[model samples]
Structure formats: C-alpha cells, structure tokens
Target chain A: MSTTISPKNAVQVEASAEVKAVHQQMLRQQRLNRAATYAVAILLVLWILVPIYLIASMAFTTPAAVRAYPKGVLPFIPFSFETMNFFLQSEGIIPGVINSIIVAIITLVLSTLIAAPAGYATSRFLFPGRDFYRLSVLAVRAFPIVVLSIPLAVVFINLGMYDSVYSLALMHTALALPTTILVIGSVFASIPFELEEAAQVFGCTPFEAFRHVVLPLVLPGIAAAAVFTFVMSWNEVFAASILTVQNRTLPAQVLAVLGQSSEPYQFAGAFFMMIPALIFIFFIRRYLFNMWGQVSK
Target chain B: MNEEKQSTQKKRKKINWAPYWLILPSLIYLALFFIWPMFRGLGLAVYNDEAALSLQTEPSRDAATAGTLPQGTQVEILDQQGNLIPPDEAGQANVITEVWYQISAEDADGNTVEGWVSESRIRVREENEAGAPTAGSVRTRIGAGDTLTEVYSEPNENAEVAGQLEARAEVAITDQSILEIWYQVRGEDRNQTVEGWAQSRYIQVFGETNTGRIDRGNTGQFTTEYLSKMVNDRFFWPATITTFLLMILIIPVQFVLAIVMALVIQARLKGNSLFLYVFTIPLGISELAVGILWFSIFTQSGFLNSFLQTTGLINTPITFLSADTRYWIIIAIWLAEVWRATSIVMVIVVSGLQAISDEVLEAAELFGASLWQRVRHVILPMLKPSLQVALILRTILALQVFAVVIALSGGDVVTVLANETYRQYSEFRNANVAAAYAGLILLISMGSAVIYLRMIRSQEEMAA
Candidate 1:
C-alpha cells in the first residue's frame, strides 16, 4: 500500500512533530508540580489525623497511665471499655446524650420543613418584601447567641416551658433555619424553572410540579442541610445550657463538667462529645464544599 | 378593547398567598418567642426597680430624711435623682426632697473621716427651725468598741408633737450619714440630716443609734434575696449585653479572618492545600477542648509564661488567667477560634474557586493581565456569592459561642449571651428569662441571614 506523497503534506508532518515535542516538555513540568502537591496533601492529612489519634488514645487509657510522666505516644495498656462505661454512667452523660440526639433530630426535621418551602419561594418568586426578608434572615444570623439565650430563658420561664429538651430543639432550629433556607434556596435556583413548567404541562398542579421536578433534584442539598443541622444541634452548648438543667444535651453536659471533671473523665467526655460531629463531617465530606458554598452564596 | 385585554393578562399573573402560609409557622415562632420576648426583656432591665419601692405619696416626710451631716462635712453624693453620681462633678443633679444618699466622707489620705471629741462628746447644734429654741446640744461619746451615743433635747414647746417622745435612747452611727435614734422627733423634716432613721421627736441624754434600714439579725435572708434580685437585675442584663457585644465583635472578626484565610489559600500559593488542611485540623476539636488546650498554654505557669521566661522576654511568668491578665485569655480564645473556624471558610472559598471556569482565567492571562488585575476583575467578582454565604454562616455560629469561654475562664473573666442564658436557665432556674435570651438569638440569626441574602441578591443584579 506504498504510495507517493506531496511535498506540502510532508512539511506539515514535520511541523506537527516539533509542536508535539514542546507539549511533552510542558507535561513533564506539570507532573513535577502535581507530585509536590500530593506530598503536601499527605502531610496535611497527617496533621488532622494525629490529634484525633491522641484524643482517642487518651480516652482509652487508664487515668493512672494518662497522668504518668513522659506520656507514651500510644496506649501502653490494652484498650479498655472502662472509660466509656464511666462516661455512660457519669452524672448526666447518658441522659444528655439521649437528649442531644432527640434535639438534633427534631431540629433537623423542623428546620428542613420550615426552610425548604421558604427557600423555594425565595429563589423562584418576586414577591413584595422578598429582599427585606432576605436581609432579615441575615441580620438574625448575625445576632449573638448569648444575647438571645438569656432573654429567651426568661421568655421560656414565662411560657412555663423551662428546662425542656423541646425548648433547646426549638432554639436550635432557629439557629439552623436561616442556613437551611439559604442552602435549599440555592439548590432550587440551580434547577431550571422550565423543568417545573414542563411538569405542570404534563397535567401536574403547582404542588405536584414541585414534588415531581424540583424535589428530586434538590433532595441532595436538603439531605446535606439535614446532616449539617443535626451536627450543629449536637455541637451546640449555649442554648442547651440556658434551656436545660437535668435534661442537658451532650455538649452542655460536657461544658458543665468542664471545670470539675477529673482529667481522664474530661478527656473522655471531650472525646465522646466530638464523636458524633466528627462522624457527621466525614459522612458529609462529599457534599461539604457544595452544600456550604451554595448556602453561603 | 386591546388595553382591557392586556390588563386582564396582568391580573392573571398575580401570586397566591400560599407561600406566605408556608412560612407562617416560623413567623409565629419568631414573633411569640423572639420578637415579643426581646421587648419584654428590655422592659425588665429598665422597669423592674420601680416595683420594689413603697407606693405611699407624702405619707411621712420622715421616711425621706437622710442621716446626720457633721457641721461643715463634705459628703460625696452616691446617687442623685435616680442616677448614679459619678466621682466627677458631671453627675451632680439638683438636690431633691425625695432623695436617698450613700455618702462617703474621707480625709485627704482617703481614710474614713472619724474623730473623738470627748468621752461623751458634746457639740452645740441648732434644729432646722431657726427661731425655735435650740434642740439643745448633741453630745457624741464613744462607748465600748465601735459604739457611739448622741444626746439632744427638744426645747421647743410649741412644736407640733404627734408621736411619742422618749429620752435616754440608744443610738448608733450605722453609716456616714445615718443616725438611727430610737425615739420619735416632732414634725417631718425631709431636709434634716437624720431623716428616714426615726421620727424627729426622739431625744436622749446618751444613746446609741442604728441607722440601717435592714435589721442585722435578718441579714442572711436579706442577702439571699438581694443576691437573687441582683442576678435578676444587674448580672443578667449586663451579661446578656456583654455577650451580644462580644458576639458582634467576634462574628465579624471571625468571618473576615475565615474569608481572608480562604482567599489566601485559594490564591494558589505554595503548599496551599497543605496549609488548608492544617487550618482545618482544629475544626475537628471541640470548642471546649480547644479552649482547654489554649488555657493550658495561657495559664499562670503555662507554656506561654515558660516560653517568655526562657526567651528572657520577661523577668517573671505572666498570669494569663489572673484577674488582671484574663483579657489575654479572651484574645487567646479568639486566636483559637481563628485556627478552628478558618478552615470552614477555606473549604467554602476553595469550592467557590473551583466553581469559577478556568477559561475566564485563561482568557485574562492571554490578555497579559497582571495577577492583581486578574484577581480584582476575574476572581473577586465570581467569589462574591460565596463570600455572602460565608459571612452569614460564620456570623450565626460565632454569635452562639459559649463552651470555649466557659471551658477557658469558668465564667470568671468572660460571659457571653449563651453563658447568661445558661446561668439563667441552669443555675437560677429562670426558664422565662432563658427563653427570652433564646428569642433574641433567634432574631439576630434570622436578621443576619436576611442581610446576607439581600446583599447577594443585589450583587447578582449588579453583575447582570
């Protein structure tokens, strides 16, 4: 299948080879940059891992060993469930943990219910005072928790609902509500309005259109909001402390014991308080950037 | 007919109020719990004191009188016209008939002005009425220990005496201005130095006076009540105010720091991702844990002091957690907050950076734009949306900061809104007040979110 070629085509092939050589050199430099980036990434990952390791190690160790001078980098003895048991049986830890879970769950549900529809309306509608509503939410977001907690304590007392888990959950929902709305709003905005219109054209009511077209698309963002809300409620202490006594949440319980606890219990309590949040963060890692970015924007 | 048809078309586009109904639950929660309670809390702070005073008007002017003022004695005004008189002259108000005084008279060296005139000290004195016969001479004498006696006679016969008169009464000088004589004196003398202590008809050859309004035996009960009142009064209000103020200060600072860190990391500097991960490591730590960690470093014999001493930066170890230096602990916590929370901003910013198309940057580069120009024109415009979101999120979280301060200072040096709320609900068992605090926080959080959304909306419009 040998055939004669034109001189013009032959010259063009030589020029293409030269261009390819330059591109290969640039690719080599890019590869070197990527290697350096990867090395740093590994070190950064270790920095986060080490402290967590230390906390876990301390939580598992006996009090005597924890107080031992020149504390070992690793647990000297075999891991014990004693520390965990101690935490579970401590003054208010178990009840607090349970209350924290209940409050967080309630907050997640209530905030999601309240925020999703508002978020959709915010993104889709051009209603009067829409801008005003947006600004109001932002202002609320900026208000200090302390300032509100004290006054709210008084209000709760007047309402005959002091020191209840319900109060804490309500307050936590308020804390999470604005972010929830913003997150879901952005998610709703990203889905084209045309999709809803199409659903309506296919014999769906406005509510049905949203249910079929918009809900499914924004479900990921809503899930992310729910997860973040749960984490926030779980981690919160101020409102929990202000709103509860015997019915304390985990973080509030940890805070109450902060000054009085033995070193081992203190470390254990801290560890226990953080586990849920850490696990939540890990589970939501994929959506962390997307969800937060949308909510913030 | 065409115009009418167009008007009908516009009317068809009107929105139903269904969305407003959807938001009603949150609105009701906000109004009942947040908005209304805030006004109520403010009312409590301002109006609660009036309820404690007696409501009688002109019942007896004797009740309004202050204690004896020594001849030519300078008395510093404690409170005037219901306002606290400052140490400086700026606080002096016009003298009023219905005044309560807490006068402190000190010598040049600032010691209490006290002196011994005689064993039964005698000083000639005139009563408030100039023409009336002298209420004799008041004889002051030191008995045993911290006891004194004042003897005086009411020589005026024409004085309207409605109360019983007693002689040889025991009296004590309770405070600088108070002479609590146990006998009744004639007429109401609101201007007399020894007012509100006893009736003016009280006179004695030598008597000890008790001028205090409260009985010493029942002091423990009074103190407990007073403490509870103070907690309800000065402590709660100031604490709440301080918490809100600190939050306002911290939230913006934290937000700016976080945003700055995010922007710096996203600028694609050397080891950017590594720095980001390092920044984020602190976020894994609980606020209390972080507070404790920093406290260990900042306490009197902690790492900071040791470092300073070893470096010869100071002669002695500093007390970072002492009453004097606890402010530094607050600063340290702020630093810890930056370390822990900045990672959040970095993460948010990085995501935003990724969202921007590379083509825009490449186009800018093709135009031979400088780094600053590209950042100013290309990068920032794209990042505004993320910045708005970051601001709202950080502000809301920062406003609620509590555990860190409590863990670090144990409510000694710092108190925030959350701490006050905690104290009210947990320690004081005042749920109504705690709910009020929660209500304020809700308002603040919602308000900030609204602001952030509006800003982003405007920016979007501007960009368009």
Candidate 2:
C-alpha cells in the first residue's frame, strides 16, 4: 500500500502492475465487444436498407436496365425513370391512390367512432356484460381475415354494396375494430376520470367535457390507434381484392395483376404502395411499443 | 333509515345503459360480416353440388356415362355412392378415383334429381373461345394410331413428317390450311413452345366451335384423392414446408439477431437511435412489397443473377425461379421473409431488453458474470413474454403467408395455405375448401399460441 520506492516495496509494485494488467485486459475485452457490436449493427442496418434501396433502384431503373441490376449487392447501376413513369402514366395509379385514401380515411373514421365510446365505456363503466363484450371482440380474431372475404363477397353482393368503397371500408372496420377497441380502452383507462369529473362539475355536459378535457388528453391514444388502423386498412389486400372488381385498392390491384405486369411496372407499383406505409410507420415509430407491445401483453 | 336504504337500492337498480349502446354497432358489424361469413365458409366445405370437381352423374356402372361436376358447387352432397369406379381402375386412370359423391342439383329440365360425377372429369370447364377460332386441338396417340402423322411446314404431305409428334404430346391444330387438306398443328417440339403442320387425317381435330372436345372419364375425386392432389402438387408441400421452415428457421436467427440488436441499440452507442430508426423502417413495408423488392434481386435477370454473372461466377444467368431449382426458390423466399420480418422481432426484443432493469445486470456483473452469461441467464429469461408473443404471432403470420410466395415464385414453384385458400375460393370457386384451409390455418395458429403460452412464462413476474 506504501508509495515509497524501497526494496521492500517491490511486491507492492508487482501487485500494482498485476492490477493494471487486469484492468487493461478488461478494457481490451470491452473494446472487442464494442467492435463486434458496431460490426453487427452495420450489418443489420445494411440488411434492412439494401432491399429498400434495391426497390428504389427499381423505381428509377429504365426498362432495359430494370432486370439488369448487378448481382449480389447492387452496383450503382444507372437509374431509369421509365418504369415509374409508365406506372404513373398508366391510368390506374391515381384512381388506386384515391380509392385507397378513401378507404383508409373511412376506416379510420369508423374505427374511431366505434372505438372511442366503447373504450370510454370500458374505462369508465363497470357495466353488465362488459367482460363478455371484450372477450367476444377478441374472439372475432379466431377467424383469419381471408376466410371472411369470399363469404363477405356473397353477403355484400346480396346487400348490393359489393363493389363499393364503403363495402371495403366496412370490412376493414370489422378487421380493425377489435384492436381499436382494445387499444382505445387502454388509452381511456390510463386517463384519470378526475379531469372529466372536474369538467362536469364546472357545469359542462358529458359530451362537452369529453370534447374539451378528455379528447385533448385522448389525442395521443387516438393518434396511436388511428395510425394502426390506417396502416391496417392501407395494407389489407385479400378482402380488398375479393370485394372489388372495377375498383380495387392499390395493393389489391397490384396483387390481381402482379404476375402479368412487366418487371418495371411491378417494381414501380410495389414501391408506390410502400411510400404511404413507410411514412405512416415513421410517424408512429415512437408508438411501435404502444401499438404492438401492449397488445401482446 | 329504512327509507334512505330503499332509495339507495332504487338508484342501484337504474343500470348504466351507455356501455351497451357503445358496443352495439361493432357487435352487429362483426356478427354480419365476420361470424356469418366464417360459418358460410364452413358450409362451403362438404357442400353437395352437381357441379363439383370429380362429382359423377351415375351411381355405379361400367357404362353409366359419368358426367363431371363443376368445382366449388355448394349443394347437398347427401351420400357417397359406393365405388362407382373400382379403386384400381381409378388408379389406372392416373387421377383420384374412389367413391363418387351424389350431388342433388337441377337438371336441364329444372327437376331435382340426384346425379353422380367423378373428381377428375371436372377441371375448370375449359372455354370454347380460342384466340384463333379457326384453329383446333388434335387428339394424339389414340388407340392403334389411326394414321401415321406427318408434320409439314407448309401443311402439305409432300413437305413430309420432317417433324415428329410424339405419342401423348398435347398439340393444338393450327389454322385450317388450303382446301383444308393439310391442317397445321402447333405444339411443343423437343425444347420449345413450337408450331408445325400435320395432315388433319392423322389426328382427330376438335374445332374451336361451341361444341368443344370431350371430357375424358378420369378418376373420381374422393376426399383422399383431393388431399393427395393438393399434397402432390409440386409447389404445395414445398411452399407449406418452407412456410413452416421459415417459421422455425427464422425464429432462432431472429431471436439471436434481435437480442444482439436490442443490446447494441440499448448500449446507447453514438447515434444508436438512428440505428433503430433505420432498422425499423421496414416494419412499415407490406409483405408484397418486400417480396417485390427481393424479387427484383432474385429474378433471372435480377440483381443476384446479374451480380453472379458480372463477377464471372457463372457464364449464364441462373433461372432462380425454375421448378428444377426448388431449393434456390425456397432460399429466395426465405431471404425475403427473414429480411422483412426480423425487424418485427427486433422491435419486440428491444422493448423487452429495455424492460430489463439496470440493477439486475449490475448485480450479475458484480458476481463476475460475462456479457454472454448475462444474456443467456438474465436477458433471455426476461424476454420470454416478448419471445412468446413474437413467436406465436410470427409463426401465425408465416402460416398466413400469401403475397410473399406469389411475389417471389409467382407461385410457380411454391404454394402455401393462404395461396390455397385464395385459389380455392376465387380461382377454384370453392368457398368450402378455402374455409377448410382457413380453419386448418386457424387451428395451427391457435395450437402454436397455446404452446407459447404454456412454454414461456415471464420470469420477472415470478421473481416479483
């Protein structure tokens, strides 16, 4: 323990040296781990981004060069505007976009309209049959979605709303409703009843209190649920294809003609569908845990 | 006191009606669209129809003139007429042959009658409308081969059978030649989709007229035969096994990758949030797009082949989609699904990692634990719920895999349950079979979920 340089202190010096060696070894181990981490991180990042870049590359690659991408990792092949231009000019793109937008918006609206009140009920009320209702909502998922589409096609045709956007919206609502109710229920439950009570006590009606005090607080939950519902509706294809003939959502149309389309058109259509979804997810990255994580728990 | 108690009890009797009012619309919507359709899909299964694939018109006999039923016909399949054709005879026919289903349907006379149909006779009723109406299909290799056929380029016998049309080869008769003496027949020559001319006399021609060719009395499609057809399809089992294998293969890879990823990102390294963002961007992409993205890379002239060729790894562009290249096709599908879906695992695992309290790890480290030990013991144990959820969810998603297989292989070399479901309901026009597939997939998903629930318990909760 002594710092004095004496012959008797040689053992102390060796012990200190040994301690330094161990510390250095630990540092070296840490450095190796850090390097491994970075290597893996970079590798994973590439794994995620390369395909996206390839899809984007297809978007810009000319028809002649469309299938001409350099192998393994793509070499910087010259970009081509032909495929995207053809897809954009082909009369189907704008209508598909519009139809998809209409469907998603309607789905969002219906899901929220139905979800908000039920979520509020689940949060605020200990009413009769509440557990049964929630359980049944969960049970709706017992049927895989594609199973419903063919039969729903019959039901919708019988209803004479078979090919309409509203018909698709209704089906999408059915798909999205359970999640919406469950999530919004969680959201509303998280918000204290005291604020709404305060608002009511201050002479506001229940609806008005909800509009002012609760909704503002409920916005984040609504936003999370709405983003999920939007993505779900936008990404859905099986039912969309089954329900529509002349009018199909973008994914549905792309799937219907996927095999027959030229390489460029297929890539372009695929990339085009990706834009909204990517953007939506980007907007909701913070809520990734909220949307999927809590649902599982 | 009694009056006050009665008043309180009376107030309790006025139940809250708002909850019922709130869920009513959604419940009705689910009832109409979800539940009802599901039941109808079940009804489609085992439905009886005169126009079902392989259904026969006569109960049993050698010369009963069995007519085939259209596939996906939902009528009362009331009874199975015993062995309309002998099983051995059906086997000889090279299709599923077993007991014929008795279908009740309206006859051309609009009377309710029971007729029998065999399975193989009713393929998708081929349309009589050909692009070239003047052309026809030639029956090849019939008994005792009427006349030795000669294919000529000019549809003239003098031109000769320079081209050989092998027995059992399906060749379509080309347009009627001059004076109709020589009819041009086009079919596959050794290696190509080829066209050549043959004397019409040598081959029997069915004109593209409304009176189409005959439906051969193929074997009956019993349930066993039907399942066998589905199983025997080249793509069916592979697609199914790949779907399963992908589910199995990707999980460990994903779990390891996800854990490592979660650890790296959680390390608070420089710009780690950026790393997370880049990783999760794919979470937004649809299954179909991810497929197309990889597809653009795996096609014959796609990125992978191009790279292989450019680098002088190979002289010719490999047909990655060929049926002969089943393993490569599966690899391409696996690559797409893994690249696309691992991010989901990463997201879930990262959250689970974040949930691991710092103190637990600090304590483990104090006990001289290494990073590997800590992960093996602490982190993985804590991640069970997430792992369970992820496994159950991803495996189910894998079972439901549809567009990805289609996008990668264009369903040329692989077929999964989702593909079958769609094909059954839409292309095959059989809602019942599709429903059966749907039900099967559901059963598998539920089974996995139950397994996950049983296997993976949250250790943190237990510790608490």
TM-score winner = 2
Query: Best by DockQ, which number?
Result: 2
Report how far off residue B132 is in candidate 2 (Å). Answer: 43
DockQ of each: 0.25, 0.38
Write candidate 1's Cα lDDT for A37-133 as tens digits.
5665555456455555665666786766545433453453657766766767888878888998999999999889988888888888877777777
Number of backbone collisions per candidate: 78, 25
Local error of candidate 2 at residue B332 (angstroms): 1.2
lDDT, each prediction: 0.60, 0.68
B379: Cα error in model 1, Å: 3.2
Error of 1 at A126 (Å): 3.0
- Tens digits of lDDT, candidate 2, B1-103: 9999999999999887888888787787778767887777655443433222232233333333333323321222222222223334544422333332222
TM-score of 2: 0.71
TM-score of chain B of each: 0.48, 0.57
Question: Model 2 - which docking category?
Answer: acceptable
10 residues in a row with least lDDT, candidate 1 chain A? A67-76
Worst 10 residues of 2 chain B by lDDT: B209-218
